[model samples]
Each structure stands twice: as C-alpha cells, then as structure tokens.
Target: MKLSAETLADLHPEISRPAYDRSKVTAGILHVGLGNFHRAHQAIYIDDLLARGGSEEWGILGAGVMPADAQMRDGLKAQDCLYTVLEQDASGDKGRVIGSMTDFAPVSPNHEGILRAMASPSIRIVSLTVTEGGYFVSAETGGFNPDHPAIQADIANPGKPGTIFGAIVEGLRARREAGMVPFTVMSCDNVPHNGEVTRAAVLGIARGQDASLADWIDDKVAFPNGMVDRITPATTEARINHLREAFGLEDARPVFCEPFRQWVLEDKFTDGRPALEEVGVQFVPDVTPYEHMKIRILNGGHAMIAYPGALLGLTYAHDAMAHPLVRGFLEKVETTEVIPIVPPVPDTSLTAYFELIEERFANPRVEDTLSRLCLDGSNRQPKFIVPSAADCLKAGRSIDGLALASALWCRYCFGEGEHHEEIPPNDPSWDRLKEASRVARDNPAAWLQMSDIYGDVGQSPLFREGFTKALNALWENGTEATLQAYLND
Candidate 1:
C-alpha cells in the first residue's frame, strides 16, 4: 500500500509503525531544508518524542526556499509527510515510519506560504540543514557575503526576498511588528560554530536592510550551535525498490541511513524546545567541544578518504575503508595531526570517538558513494581539512598527511580519475579549481595561492613544503604508489 495516514492502519503487522496519533500532532517547528539527513536525524527525534506521548505541539512543518525543493514538497505531501526510515547494520535492517513532519508548504515562486508559516506564533524554532554553502558566507573573511548576487538581489527587493537569509529577516520583521516572540534559529549543518554562522548570516542580511531590525534579532533570536551526525545517502531507485520489496509499500521520500546517529545541541533556545533530551539528543551549555570533535574527526575523516577514493576508482565509502592504504593514511593523519588539535571533549575520549567513527564508516550496509563525499570540495575542504592544517602549522607539527590529503583533492579536481574516467564538475568553483589543479600539477604552490581557500596557511613554509612534495609524488607515481610511500614513511 502507498504510505499515508489514511493507509497506515492497513500496513503489514511486522513493520514498525508510529504508535502516536499523527492527527493530534501540530506544527511547532518550521524546518527549512527537507533533506534526508533532517528526516533521518532531527525529524526522527521529534517522531520518537511524540511517540512517547507528550510533545504533540512540537511537530515539524517541512519547508524549503529553493526552487529545487518543489520535488521534495510534492513527494512528502503525496505521502502525507509520512515516510519510512530504513536503518541497516551488519546484522539486519529495520524500517519505521516517521510522521513528525506534519505538513510541507507549497513550493511557490514568492515563497509566501513559507514566510507565513515562519511568521506563525506557534513556531517556536526555525531550524535549518541547508548544507555548508547555503549560509552565503564569504570564503575570504568567514563572514556573511553581503556582495553575493543573491544577497544583493534580496537587498534590492526586501519584501520579496529570494534567499533564505532574506526570507528569515522578513519573517522576523513581520513577527516583531505583530508583537510575536521571535523563534529560535537553530543550525544543524556541519559548519563550524553553525549557530554563530547562522546568526552572522541572518543578522548581516538584516543589518543591510535595517539596523534596528538586525539589533532586535541579535538581542531576541537565539541561534543555538549544534553538532548533528548521521550517514544518510541520497535516495535512489534501488533503495526505493528495496523498501517496496521488503515492506510491500510505496514511499516517494523514504530515507536510508545507518543505525547510528548523534545530535549535540547548545541549550540556548529563545522561546522553548521539545524535550529532545528525553530522546537521544544531548543538550549542553556549550557545543564547541563536541562540534570540534565531530567536524575535525568524523567529517575530516570523510575528506581524508573522499578524494583518494574517487581517484582510486572506489565507488562506495566502505570500499575506501576496506582499502588498506586509504585506511592507513586516514588513521595516521587523524591520530597524529587532527586529534591532537581537538580539545578533550566532556565524557568522550578522542581515541574512543575515533574507534566509533571508524566502525561507522566501515558499515557495509551504508553504501555511501564517494561521489557524494567528493561533491562541493571547494566548500568542504576548507571547513573540514584546512583548519586542522592551520592548527598543526601553528603548533609546529608535521602536516604531511594533511597536505597529502589536500594534494589528493587537487588531483581529483584535475577532472580525471586514476582510471582516466572524466570526473564531472561537482563544485561551484569548478572552473577555477580545474585551472588551479592543472597548474598545480607542476607548481604545487599555485593551488595554495587561491587565498579564498587556503588563506595564510599556504604561505607557511612547512605547509608549502609538505603540499609541494605530496603533489609532486601524486603526479609522478599516482595515488596508489604515493599512498604506499606515505603508509611506509
């Protein structure tokens, strides 16, 4: 049967269905990015909370500002915002229906429906998972990009704002004029100090429009920093078929992920929040320690493998993990370089955390594509790998492995894998990245001179030496030979 509230009663008895009343659940959170990660992570938490029988008013209203969101809107609405989450591990697989998302706004040109939903007094939290690059942050200053064309357009037409930041500013302005409480803006993206970044973007856009409005948002709206972890691969026809064959059901927007998930959030919500702590989420006074550990270790590990994996023609993440040379390179770099810079997090040891990360990456059932990891390297490498290199350089530690990882990225960007397969353009900065990669094949320092990405780290003598050497080795001997050298050296 098609998965919907109307058909829920007729589902197979063996399937794990929602125990709570979906009709009683009301929208309290307006989530901006209705991606699979949000559904698998945050929305699942809210679903579980409602299943426990109290937080009915905290259900989510899935929303999106981009035109691409029209696909998601139609899919979720067709299913009554009811989708299946299939969790897989070594042993078996389990499927559960997630109904925390009560509704999705119609995908319209002006986004009036989304703005109205955001202006609602019932929405206590405005959360987002709009990827790393969605915040309109300047790569040079690590601040809001007021000069971005989208931001510029929004500035030209404030009332009919186009970007997410502009929409947020307009919504907050409406709420302020109506004397309604400003909702807390929570960021669940992988960026460092995500809450702070969201605040900068929102307030930066608001300031350009109205200084007093920006000040009001700064003083009133709370942007809680959070660390969210889950491996949600992009849904595909094979996965959909697996669900249909396994459960005898049809769901257009089903999410497939590993069984493991973690969310560490700073307790700074302005209005109020669900008792997500009662579920699996960790609520803390500060999320920095947790954030650093996950971003640097977990996300850094992904960057470590992605380029080399793609260059080596490995298809899946587990394939890269199973490769001895790639695995060894990742271990050496993470343990020696990355983990040393990360402060000791509360209740967690860096070593044990790495062990968990390793196991999760090697989960055979995940089948996460290296292509997915390799996408948007222009944004991810700086956030995930560059910071560690900078920290190591300041501490006078060797950044050889980190440099090699960066070199691998340059090699991957050459638009050809080791198998001579044309690596399609995946990054927004593809033209410049391709040119730099082609030049860096002979002059490695040329790549580092892209100041928007490497910053002053490129000028460091040690970093330059290491990056140049790694790039030379990668060019001369290729990925496998260079990986072997790094492993043995």
Candidate 2:
C-alpha cells in the first residue's frame, strides 16, 4: 500500500504512526531546507513531543527556497506531508511515519509561498538546516560576508530576493510592520556558533536594507546555537526498495538513518517552543562546550577518514572504518591530536565519546558514503579539518596527522581514486582545487597557499612542513603505503 494519510492505518503492526490528532496540529514553527537530517532529527523531536500529548500548536510547516526543493515538496504533497523514517542499527530496524509537518508549501520561483509562511503570525519560530556552507559566513572570519555572490544578487534585487536570508529579512520586516512579536531564528546546522552565524547573515542583509531593521532584528530576534547529530546517508534506490520489501509500503524519498539522534540546544527561544526536553533534548544555558566536543571529535573524525578512504575507492563509511589502515589512522589522529585541542564537555568523557564515535562509524547498518563525507571540501576543511591544525599549532602541539588528512584531501582532489578510477568533482570549488592539486603534485606547498581556505593554518611552518611531506609521500607511495608510513612514523 502507498504511504499516505488514508493508508497509514494499514501499515505493518510494528510500524508506528502518529497517535496525535493531525488535524488539530497547527503550524508554529517554519523550518527551511527540510532534508533527510531535518526529517530524521528535529521533526522527529516534534513528533515525539506531540506523541507525549501536548504542543499541538507547535507543529511544523516545512518550506524550501532552492529550486531543487520543488521535487521534495511535490513528493510530500503526493503523500499528504507524511514520510516514513526507517531507523536502523545492529539490534533492530524500526519504521515510524512522521506527521509533525502538517504541510509543506509548494516551492515557487520567487519564494512567494515561503515568504507568506514566514510572515504568518502563527509561526513563532523559524529554524534552518541549510548546511554549514549555506550560511554565507566567511570561514576565515566566522562573520557574514556581504560580498557573497548570492548576497550580492539579493542586494541588487531586494524585492525579488534570491537567498534564504533575503527572504528571512523581508519576512521579519513584514512581521515588524504588522506589529507582531518577531519569531526566533534557530540554526540547527553543524557550523561552529551556528546561531551567531545566522544572526550575522540576517543582520548583514537587513542592514543593507535599513539600519533600523538591522537593529531590531539584532535586539529582538533570537538565534540559538545548537548541535545536531545523526548518520543519514543520501537516499539510495536500495533504501527505497527496502521500504517496499520490508514494510509493504510505497513511498518516495523515505529517510534511512542510524538510530542515534541527538540535539543540544540553548534555551534562547523567542515566544515559546515545544516540550522537546521531555523527548531527550538537552536544553542548556550554554551549548559551547558540547558544540566544540562534537565538532572536533565526530565531524572532524569524518573529515579525517573521508579523503583517505575515498582515495582507496571505499564506498561506504563503515567499509572505510573496517579498513585496518584507515581505522588506525583515525584512532591515532583523535587520540593524539584532535581530542587534545577539544575543550571539556560537562558530564561527558571525551575519550569515551570518541570510543562511542568509533563504534558508530563501525556500525555496518549505516551505508554512509565516503563520498558524502568527501563532499564540499572547500567549506568543510576550514570548518572541520583546518581548525584542529590551527588549535594544535596554537598549543605548540603536533599537527602531523591533521596535516596528513589535509594531504589526503589535496590528493583526493586530483580527480582520480586508486587504480585510476575517476573521482568526479566533489567540492563547489572543484575545478580550482583540482588545478591546485595538479600544481601541488610537484610543489606541495601550493595546495596550502589558498589563503581564503587555509588562512593562518597554511602559513605555519610546522603545518606547511608536515603537509608538504605527507602530501609528497601520498603522491609517491599511494594511499595504502602512505597511511602505513604515517602510522609507522
């Protein structure tokens, strides 16, 4: 049977459906970029809160700004804004149909419906999961860059704004003009200090329109930083087939994710929020400690493994973890290098946290692609990999392993895997990166010379020395021999 509101009751007995009255649920939160992570993580939290029997008015209204989002919008509209989340681990595989999203607005060219939904008085919170690079903040300075091409376009045509921040600015302007309390702008992306980055993006656009609007948004609107975790791979045909074969249900774009999900948000909501705490959300006064730990350890760990595994033609993350050389390289980097720079988290052991992360990476059920981790190197390296190098250099520690990770990235960017397999362009700046990699083949320092991407990390003698040596070794010895060399060193 097709998965929809009408057929949900006939699903497998073990499959859970929304127990709450979907008709009574109203849109109080408007979430942008409703991808698999949002569906598997934040939306599920809202679903759980409602299942506990309260916060009906806090239901979600999904919106999308990008042109590709139209397909997602159309897919959900076909199924009554309902989708199944297949949460799987070694012990179990459970499916739950999520209905917290009362409805999704069909995407329009100029974001007409999204603007209307954003300006609606009933929507008290606007959250975002538009990815780390989507924030338009300069990696060099963690602040909004008005100079971004999209922001530049939005500046030229403010009325028919082109970016999410532009739409957000206009929506907040409409709310302010109509004498309504402003909704909070919560950022659930993995960037460091995401809420603050969001605030900068909003005000940077708003100030270009009017200083008064900028001040109001800065003072009244709340942008709360948060840490969100889940291992959700890009949807695959096998997953879609799994749903049909296992549950006897037909659905488009059903999410397949690891059972582990976590959200640590600071309690800086504007009007109100759901009873998310009851559903295992950690609401704290400060999310900094938690953010640093997860970013450096988990996110950084992914980056550390991504390139080397990609070079070796590994398909999935678990397969990479299973490789002895790759697994050993990750362990050495974390235990000796990455964890030392990470700040202490409250009531959490960093060593034990790393152990858990290793186990999570080793979970055979999650088919997280190494290429997924290898995507967006230009944005991810500075955020995930380079920062650790900077921290190690700042503390007068070794950056040998982190530099090897950097070397692997440069090698991976050369547009070929081992056995001469074509590694298609992955990053947004792939062309430039590939050319730099070719040049760095002879002059290895040329890769780190990208000041915009590497900044000060590229300038340090220790990092340059280590990166050049490791990158040189990889080019000559290949990934397997290169990793063994590093591990043996």
In order, the Cα lDDT scores of the candidates are: 0.90, 0.90
TM-score of each model, in listed order: 0.98, 0.99
Q: Residues 1-489, candidate 2: write the lDDT tens digits.
A: 998999988999878999899999999999999999999999999999998886899999999988889899999989999999998889878999999999887687678887899778899999999988898977666568999988887767766788888888988989899989999999989889999999988888899888999999988999998999999988899989988998898999699999888999999977888878899999998999998899899998998888888888888889999999999999999999999889889999999999999999988887889999999989988888898899899999999999999999999999987788899989889999999999999999999889878989988999999999999899788999989998998
Tell how far residue 97 is off in model 1, in angstroms.
0.5
Residue 37: error of model 2 in Å?
A: 0.4
Estimate the lDDT of model 2: 0.90
* Model 1: per-residue Cα lDDT over 1-489, one tens digit each: 899888888876666888898889999999999998999999999988999998899999999877889998998898888999999889888888888988998777667887999888999998998999888876667777788888888877888988777888999999999999999999989898999999988987889889999999999999999999999999989999988898898999889999999999999989989999999899999999998899999999998988898999899999999999999999999999999999999989899999999999999888899999999999998888998999998898889999999999999999987778899998999999999999998889999998878888878889999999999999899999999999899
